[model samples]
Target: MLTQEPIYPKPFLKWAGGKTKLIQQYISLFPQKIINYYEPFLGGGAVFFYLYNHYFLSSAFLSDINPELINTYLCIKHDVEAVISLLQQHQANHNQEYYYYMRSYNTENSVERAARLIYLNKTCFNGLYRENSKGEFNVPMGKYKNPQICNPEVLRAVAKALQVAQIEVKPFETVLNYAKSSEDFVYFDPPYHPLSETSNFTAYSRDSFNKDDQIRLKNVCVELAQRGVKLIQSNSDCPFIRELYKDFKIYEIQAARAINSNASKRGKISEVLITI
Candidate 1:
């Protein structure tokens, strides 16, 4: 009999500002050991997946303010087979016409909604999640010659990884409620404070993360640090963010993102990694 090799999971969504590429730079920064891990702004969840794959974690708290996203996670965690079944349908029927139909679709079924979001994510322009003034997904269909709309292997692995996590929909500040000791580690990958005028793109959800929210996040970090909670945050390396976490140990991380509206501004940018 052969023993099966463990399958490590990567992020299932193609979220904007995802830290998948930056994980290498963060590896040395992540705590060697942690009992509890919390990620408040769980976008693509590259960091959470990374930590789970690399370290020994007893518990994890993953959350985001996006209701649809949270629901998708719950559906996948609870019933990945249902999601895969629906995704297989989407994968088989994927076409330009069907893509728009799925985009304009409204579904109350959690499994169907999760499948729709995943389909759109793979086929949407740049895998960008942008909502309109009326709070509807407004991104156009992407020009993918062959998009992998469904991958049961990846989804199953993701579901297995999430079995140990308590996923939720909550504000970033709510992290302070549970994380209170050095054993608790919080990795914040908030909607960054824009570095330039053209880069102030926060349309990931209906409620934009404005400057006030940035300040509030800083305060939470300060408080978490005070309680001896291990922390690592990723944000734009701008003066404002710099001044905000002035006392924390800041390291310059080289990052490149194509999320800016201006194509010219999407290359080798500097981001800050604050640790405590």
Candidate 2:
């Protein structure tokens, strides 16, 4: 097996509520000699790319509950150029009518579908990937004159890095169960419990993370820590969040919200960085 090296580049995406800032702040807590890495909630793979770039692990296991997100990763790893070509076409024909038409269409594994996803993600307001009950891509187009549709270099680099790591689409419990030793480091970034009923934005999937899920995740964190797996998690800063990880080291950090469609609603928000 080829030994993994640090210095991999990041994938280009406008991931909503990404942890790029948080991870950079608390990266020192990550295990230096990571034999295996596990990320159960692989949103945009922001932390995954960071670890790959820093040479933290020889093997990585990435899992997500969202099937479409997993499909997008698979497409990038397997057929990035084709996806790029289709994304370019979507960029070329970007309009309100075209956006709705593409949003309503269902074409699995087609390059057009992947392109629409990328195009909408790049051009949509705040790169928010929310869907209605019918699961249509409904976010309005953004105001950028020339958004980057496809980054061939970033795609190739991410594809190569993912080729070396293991990828899965499963429940969080299944992925957490695999980490039973000290050689593994688990970095969890679960869907946060809303700070308030009015501020909730858990629409990544139809099933949102509730208070029960938050408790369940805390239990999983304790289990991982007891088994000696270095763990770190980021979440919304709230009384419930602090109480849940009372036993762990929680760092309160302020980060700007870059994904909200409303300009007034976009601003700095406190977050918790729990390490164990």
- Please give the lDDT score for candidate 1: 0.91
Could you tell me which 10 consecutive residues in candidate 2 have the lowest summed lDDT?
4-13
Q: Candidate 1 — which residues are off by over 4 angstroms?
A: 1-6
Q: Which RMSD values do the candidates have, in order?
A: 1.6, 4.0
- The candidate that wins on TM-score is 1
Taking all chains together, each candidate's TM-score versus the true structure is 0.96, 0.91
- Find the 10 residues in a row with the least total lDDT in model 1: 195-204
Q: What lDDT does each candidate get?
A: 0.91, 0.79
Which regions in candidate 2 have their CA more than 4 angstroms from the true location? 1-8, 260-262
Clash pairs, model 2 backbone: none
